[model samples]
Target: MLKIDDLIIDKEFEELLPVLTPEEFVRLEQSILKDGMLDPIKVWEEPGTGRNIIIDGHNRYRILKKNNISLNYWENYKFMYADELPTRDDVKRWMLEQQLGRRNLSEAEKYEMVQKFKSVFEQKAKKNQSLGGKGSTNLPKVDTRKEMAKATGVSEGTYRKMDVVMKSDNEDLKQKLREKKVSVDAAYKEVKSTDQKPITVKQQIDRLDKRINDIDKTIESLQVEKEEIIQRRTSIFYALDIKCPVKYRWDKKGYSNTFPCFWKCQIYIENEEYENIFGEYSVYYNEFPSDCDMEKIPETYRNDFRMIWKKAHDEIKALQDEVDKKSMENAKKQDEILKNAMKLIPTDEDKVILKQFYRVLANTYHPDNKKTGNAEMMKHLNDLKAVWGI
Candidate 1:
């Protein structure tokens, strides 16, 4: 039996209809338990995943599952199939059309269904164009959103407000729209007013705090990147029997017990060293930007004395450049190694042995052998074969 959570739903389809409330679902489940499902659930298996994707009767199927009702073909559910529907896209499009053609929908349902149809069609059209072909829908490219809104019975002005409500990141606001608790005009007004409202002192402080944290994160990312580049360089140096020395020198002028002292980093490629292979970043020894001074500057010189920021900026830039240069140099060294490796021409005897090995590995990793095979391993093997020109 497929888990409820595992059912693959089209986003367009989900957005077309409102999800049942908890109480509504329980009532539906009770009815299904007493009456059984009168409607057949339409579904098809996903192409690659082999998972069941529902095309229609989602609410009924959900209720049946909740009541522990098994869906048997010809008894409870039916496969929505046609000879011409060769792809998932075609099936999905057909399902949407079927939904839109329904006569029993409410005014709300009709509007929502039409919206889903337009959105899905527009997406397919753009996708087709990106693939160097035109959409089969025969819809034009000009003012598509406007055309869709007009077709779906929403005026341009009303559609604009509704669109804002639809796209708002607030879940409660979105829920209210779905439940029809707030009219589009009301939702739009609420959202607009909230958005236009001036930020309070706390919110401004929070925003500044978030910005500081974001910058701190960026510094950490750069620090990590620099560490990786150094590690890669060290690995290549080890392979070539060369060792490089690195030195650190700190500025004493800006030193304070409460604040941080800025430092300069340099590499010594020719010198000898028995230690220092800083590969991955470690919290113990590493003094990153996050580790630096967090003490607030005195209000006396906050605006005029901005040298601290400049110093930090210059240090970060110089260090980042050094890391990038080393990375490029190391990458060239790696390419040279790969070129030398590629020069090893396999003899006929070697090819015969390699062919046998490949055949056995390919069989083991084939997708059909679900028990023993892994898709990732198969792809990796294929990639290596291509790289080696085998």
Candidate 2:
């Protein structure tokens, strides 16, 4: 007597199931249309709510609804309820096991299911400990790696390599692993090779230099944007024929504390036309005694002024904060570059000899000397000195 509408689709439970491919879905739909629901829909009757939540046979349920077929029409249609699963975690474990048992899953999908199973096992273990219970379920012990390997039908070492492959940033490698186009060993080796490549000192300096340049450019851009906002705010104040508030000025000192008072001042009131706008609200000098009711202002001016006011203050503060952060980052990068460059210098004991050698080289290759001058050698010597941070 249960109707299709009576069954609930829990999103959390549904997400645990794999999505069917278009071709697979089409085949399933066609089969149901012809065969008329052979497999039973397994559901869980949630206590208190009394709702039959679909835990299995989601695809069959979807097909049936799409074709407007009623569950009552088929005499063989069955409903298998999961009455023993008293908790959500129990249901999740069951779902994961069902997914692991299916033979259609790709390697990537199987690996992902094992990971989910491991996570659920850990969570259940923690819950049991908190409740002073021991060995409640047959879930694996602390050594999840062994369990994961067994579930995936691979050795522990191979499972470890598979873990590395899954966690790597290479999307193509991951896709290949999923499709069985690449082995876990190959993908893991590639990732390790890429990560193990050492960065030379020169490369490190170049990277730091590039980062400093990028931060400088970002600060410049933010400054330009801040200037534009200030210009717009100035124009609005000018159009209103009122002197711009000192707090609103971009160059004003202690402006952050004073800016909030601008909305309440009699300056916005202008002449008698808007005098009573403040009404019972008292306006004080240089600061508002109470909250400013912005709704009293004329719609045309209020919107524009409020927008520009907020934009001007917020943009300026945000720009300053970003610029300060970038400046600090730039300083750190410059310091790092200096530290790397200093590493090229000789030890203290060799400093005197090294300086003497450098002096002789500089004199011999002096670009300013008419007879001894060798411009190329002088340039090379200077470049060496710069690299050593001398």
The model with the greatest TM-score is 2
- Residue lDDT tens for model 2, 212-311: 8657655654464365455444434435755332122333333453343332222233333432112222222212222255654444455544554555
Candidate 1 regions exceeding 4 Å error are 1-17, 45-52, 62-68, 82-85, 94-119, 127-139, 142-144, 147-152, 168-194, 200-390
Per-residue C-alpha lDDT of model 1 across residues 1-390, encoded as one tens digit per residue: 444455566543454455679898887777777887766777766443355667777888767666666666666666654454545447646766676566554334445655545544565556656655444456445455675566556787877777676654445876776677777788788888887877689777776876686576556544643654565554455454443333333443454422232333321223354433322121112333232232332233233223333444465556556766777999999999999887786666776777777778889998999778988989988876665456
The lDDT values for all models are: 0.58, 0.65
Question: Local error of candidate 2 at 304, Å?
Answer: 53
TM-score of every candidate relative to the true structure: 0.38, 0.46
Task: After the best TM-score superposition of candidate 1, give how far the Cα of residue 379 lies from its true spot, in angstroms.
Answer: 68
Over 4 Å off in model 2, which ranges? 73-82, 131-141, 197-390
Name the TM-score of candidate 2.
Answer: 0.46
